[model samples]
Target: MIRTDDTRYALRPGVTCLTVPGGAVLLNPPHNEKLAGLTPAQSQALKTLNQGPATASALAAESDSVTTLLDRLAGAGWLEVTVRDGDRDLYTLRPFSTPPARPSTGDGPRTVLSKFTVIHRDPDGLVLEHPTSWCDFRVHDPRLLALAAGADPTELGLPESLSARIAADLRWGGFTADPAAEDLDFTTRSWSAPDLWFHRRSTLGSRTVTWDNFGPTAWAKDEFPQRPAHRPAYPGAPIALTAPDLGALRATDPALTAVLEDRRSCRSFDDARPITLTQLAELLYRSARTRSVETSPDGAELPSRPYPSGGGVHELELYPVVRTVEGLAAGMYHYDSFEHALRLVAPADSIAVQRLLRTTTATLANGAEPQLLLLISARAGRVMWSYKSVAYANILKHVGVLMQTLYLTATAMRLGVVAQGFSDTAAFTAATGADELEECNVGSMILGTPGDRPRTTD
Candidate 1:
C-alpha cells in the first residue's frame, strides 16, 4: 500500500501544489478544497509527482518527510493507485476522493453500474452523467443507454469506443461514485466526509427540481422521468402557515394595486440626480433595518428586519457600493442594520472596489451602469451552524424573500432597483475583505434615481 521504486504516477486533473512565501499549499480545485499547507520538501515532491508518479525513494530525495506528506494528502482524498507506461504503478492526485479499489466477488450474481449514476437524454441524444459530481459525458449512439442502465455492454452491441469509455469510467469510479452510491439493497455505501459531500452536492443541487427552485440551478437529464414517490422538501421542519386570515387577497387602495401592477424594472439610472441620503436611509430602514434584537438562551442574538428569514437568524448583510448617493462620498459602505448607519469600508477608487463595480456593471449590461449597488452576502457559519441539513437551500430561500423586499421597498420609494442574474463571487469577497469560507456573496442588486418613469398604472 506504500510507494516503491517500481512505482510511477501522473497528476490527476486539477491537483496542484505551490510553495508560497507564507508557506507551501496544494489544492484540488474541483471540490473547492483548500487543503492543509505543505512543507518545502513536500512542495518539491509534488513538483516531481506532476511529471508522473514516482516511488517513495524518488520523492524522499526532495525531503525526508515527502512520503509522509503525500500520505497526508492522500488521506485528504487526493490519491489513487494507477499504472503508468505499463511498467510501474504509483499513486495520483484527484480533486475528488476515491473509494476503496472496488469489491471483489466470489463468482455469484452479477455486476452493474452503481445506481448513483445515470444514462439520460440531452440535446445530444444520450449521455453518461455522474450524479455525485455533475460530471457528464456525451454518448454517440443512443443504444448505449441500455448498457448504462444496467444492461451488460457486451450483449447490447454498443459502439466499441463507447464501450471502452464506459468501462474506463466505471473502473475510475466515475460511474459507481463513492459516498452516495447505494448497495444492491439501496443503502448508502460510504460515510466519510468526502463521500457525504458528494452525496449532498448532487442530491440537493441537481438531482431534483422544485417549483420555486431556490436550490442549485442545474439538473441531470432523464428521459420520460417519472415522479418519485417522495420528493425533496421545499420547506423545512414545522410548517409556518402563519399568514393572517384576512378575508380575500385584495389591495384596498386602487392606486396601490395600480402600483403593484405598474412596477417596472429600471435597467438605467440617472447619475446627474443622485438619491438623497435621507432616501437611502428610508429605503434601508423599510426593507432591511433592524426593528428589535433578541438573544436566545444559547446566547445567539437575532434581529428583526422587514424581510422574513428562516429562524430569524438575519445572516444576510448588505454592502452598498455607492457611486452617487447624496451626502455620501463615492465608496463602499457596510449597512449596519442595528445602527441604521453605513459603516465606511473603502473608497470607491480602490482596485478591489473598482473591480467589483466594473464587473457588476458589465454583468448588468442593461444599457447603463449603476451608481448604487448592493452586495448581499450570507454568513455561512451563522446559518449552517443551526440547520446543517437544509442550511444552503434555506439560505437561498431567504435570499429570495429579501430580494422581493428590496424590490417592493424600492418601488414604493420610486427608486430603480434590479437584481443581477449573477455576480463575480471572488471579486465581491475581495471588495468586502471577508474570509471567503465564512462569508459569501449570494446575490446583488442595483438602484438609483430613475432615468424616466415607465408607468405606475396597470
Candidate 2:
C-alpha cells in the first residue's frame, strides 16, 4: 500500500530484460511469471527504473506512456515499492509472488500478526515471511519492526499517521490478520503451522512461490553442477554379488502372485542356520542392482535399476549391517549397486553397528537381531541438484518402491523380510562417518532365513 506522492519504485531483484524481435521481454527467475512482448518504450522505462529507485514524478517528463507502463509494471509485482519520509528510508515491500491487494482507506478491521508469519534472517537480513504470502517486508526502520512486534504507536512515540499507514500496509501484505475472520476450518485446525508450511512448500500449485521441476527445468544444475551418479565405491575388499539367473528362475522360482501373497514381515530369524553370503548377494542383485546407466541431454548419468525411481535418479544406497551372516563376517557393508558388489564400511564389532542391531532387537518382544539389517540411505544432493521442493518427497517415494522390490524378491527367495518403521539417522551417520545432510538413512529393513515358528505379524 504505497502512497503515490511519496513512494519510490525499482525493478525487483532477479528480473532480466531481454530485447526481442518486435519488442522486449521481462523475465522473472525462480517463478513462472514473466512480462513477455513488451514495447520498446516499456523496456526503456524499465531500464530507467533499473538504474535505481525513482519517484513517479521524477520520470514524469519522459512521456505519459512511460508513466502508464510504470504503473502497470508496479501493479504486476515487477517493481518493489518503498515508502519514504524526507530523504530517510522507511521499509520496502518485496513481492515473491503477486503483490497483495491494496489496503482500503479509512477505519480498517482490527489486525493481529498472522499465525503463519515467521521472522528470520535470510541471506539479506531479518525479514518477515508467510508460508503462502505473495510478498514479504524488508524492514529498513526499527519502528516498522516494532509495529510487527505488536507495539503501539504511543509505546514507540511515533506519529499516529505514520504508524497507521505502516499497519495498514502490513495487514494488506497478509502478515497481519483480522482475528474474527481468521480461518479455523477443520483442515486448518487439524494441521500444525510447520506441517502445513511443509505441505505447501513441497508440492506445486498456483500458490507456489519457489522454483521446481514444473517444466522439468534444470535451473538448479545451472547454478550448481549435479553430483556424480554413483558414490565412489568405499575403500575395502569388494565382494562380488551373485547375479541370479532369470532363465533358471522361470522353472524354479515361485509364481509372482504366490510371492505377493506369501510376503509377511517375519521378525524371527533362523540363527542356527544364518543367511549365507550367496543368498544375501542374490537378494541384492534381484532387487537393487543398477541395470544400466543412461545420460541425460544435460550430460547427467541417470541409472536404471530393478525399481522405478523419480527421473531414473537412483539416489538411494543400501548398507547391510550383518550381525549373523554365515560367510560375510559381522560387519556393515555398502552394497555397490553399480558393481553388484559389497564394500565393507565398518568391521564386525563397530559400536555404531552394534547399537543399530541392538535397537532393532529391542523392538521385538522375543526376537534377536536379524541376520541382515539393510539400511537404505539417500544421497540428498543427487535428487536436489535436478529438482526443488519435491526432492525429499521423491527420495521417500524411492525408498518405498525399493522396499517393495526387496519384499517381493525376498519372498520369492523364501527368506524373511520386514520393513523397519523408523531409523536413527544420527546413529547411521556415526557408523558411516558421512554428513547427515549429504547421506542419511531414509528407510531400513531386516532380511534373514525365516525361522520354523508360525509367521505372526509383529
Candidate 3:
C-alpha cells in the first residue's frame, strides 16, 4: 500500500481510486469495464452495502430484501465483513499512513521601498518623471514656503517653525552648507547632525545661527485636507437648442405621442416563439428605408420620413444578427434598407451570438435569445464634409428618433424591445466590416417575444 499525501492509485486496468476528505474513497470505473458476474439484485445490494456498515437484518430492510447474495459472497471469502454495534456495515482493508514533512528556508526580514527619479526639467521649473509610486510630497522653492503657509499650509501639515526656517534662509542668503550641492541627503543622521546651520548675510558681513537639536519632533501631521468646495454659477438667460420634453411634443403629433406612451426597456422574452417575417419587414420599412420618393423641380429625389439628417444625406446603415426570426437562418445579415431586404453577411453559431450580444447589452432571461439584433453605423465623412457640428448632432438625434419608432411598433405587436448603447465599439466595428472611411457605431436594439406584461393600475 502506498502511503503519501496527494497520491494516485490504480484500482483496476484503466480505472483509478480517488481519496477525498473525511476518509472517503471514490471508485472511478473505466468506460469498457462492467460488473459482469453480479446479478442485477446483487449489484443493487452491493451499492447499498458500500454506503456504510450494517447488520444483515438492517441491510435487507434497506435493500428491500436484496442482501441474500451479499451473505453468500462474504462466506466465499470474496468480500470481508466486520460486525459492529448499532446499524453500520464495516469492510476490512489495508490501512495507510500520512507522509513526512519537508524542510524550509528561514531567511531574515525584508521590506519594499518606493523610489523616484527626475526624467525631464523645463526652463520654467516644471519637472516631469515616472514615479515608482505616488507620494504626498511638495516640490517647490524654499522662498515660496512663507507665501504657501499664508494661503493654506494646514492642508500640507508641515510645522510653522520649519516653514519659517526655510523662508528666512532662502530669502536672506541661500543654502549655507555648499551652494554647489546637487544631491541633498535627508537621512536620520544628517537630520540630527550638529554641523547643520543656517548662514545669513547681514549689512556688516556673513553670519551663522546654530541650533542645539534639529530634526522632526514627531510624525508631521500628514493627513492633508481636501481643497474647498466650489459650485459653478448658473446662466441667467435661456439657451437655444435645448431638447423639448417628449410629453409636450406628444400632444401635437399622434405618432410621437404613441411612442412616448409605449416606450419601455424589456428583458424577459419567450424562447420558442419569435417575430414573423412580415413584422420584421414592417419594422425596417417604418424606422428606415425609403417609403415614398419625392421629386423636386430640379429632378432631385428625397425619402419621405420624419427623422431629419444633415443635407438629407441619410448615411446611417443597419446590420441585423438574426437568431430566431421565423423563416430566417440563424446568422448575421446586413439590412439593405434601400432595397428593403436582408442580405446574408456571415454564418454565426450560438456562442458567437452570445458573445456579440453580451458585449453590447445585458443577457436575456431563461436563456431566451433575441430574434433580431440591430446595429446602426454612421458614414461620418459623407455628412461631415458638408456640415461639421450639425452632422455630429444630427446623427445622434436620428438614432433617438429611430429607437422611438422601434419601441412603438414593438409595443403595438406585443413584442419585447431594448435599446443598448454601451458596447465594445472597436470589436463591433471590426466584426461588421464597415471600417471603410470613418464609419462610427451609433446604437443597437434587441427585439423578441414579450414574456409577461405588467398590469396597469387605475
Which prediction has the highest TM-score against the true structure?
A: 2
Task: Give lDDT: candidate 1, residue 458.
Answer: 17
Query: Candidate 3: which stretches are off by over 4 Å?
Result: 1-259, 292-302, 350-354, 360-363, 366-368, 453-458
The TM-scores of all predictions, comma-separated, are 0.49, 0.74, 0.41
Worst 10-residue lDDT window for candidate 1 reads 226-235
Tens digits of per-residue lDDT for model 2, 109-181: 7677776777777777777766777777887767666766677544555566666767767776878876555
What's model 1's overall lDDT? 0.60
- Model 3 over residues 1-458: C-alpha lDDT tens digits? 11121111112212222322222233322122223345455454455556543445444423433444543333222332332212221112111111112112244222111122221333424221212111111233333333323333222344464433333322212111221231255542343222121111111111111111112111122332211111111223211112223375345435656656766777666666787666676667656764455554533344555466545556677767777788676766666555566766556754544566665435455445567887777766545544422455667777887777777767655667887765456655656555646677788888887667442210
Winner of 1 and 3 under TM-score: 1
Q: Of the candidates shown, which would achieve the greatest lDDT relative to the real structure?
A: 2
Pairwise lDDT winner, candidates 2 and 3: 2
Residues 162-276 of candidate 1: C-alpha lDDT, one tens digit per residue: 3443455454445543323344334455443345554565343533333233232212212222222111121222211122222432333235665566466776677899887
Ordered from best to worst lDDT, the candidate numbers read 2, 1, 3
> Deviation in angstroms for 316 in model 1?
0.2
Name the lDDT of candidate 3.
0.45
* Position 63, candidate 1: lDDT: 55
- What is the lDDT for 3 in model 3? 17
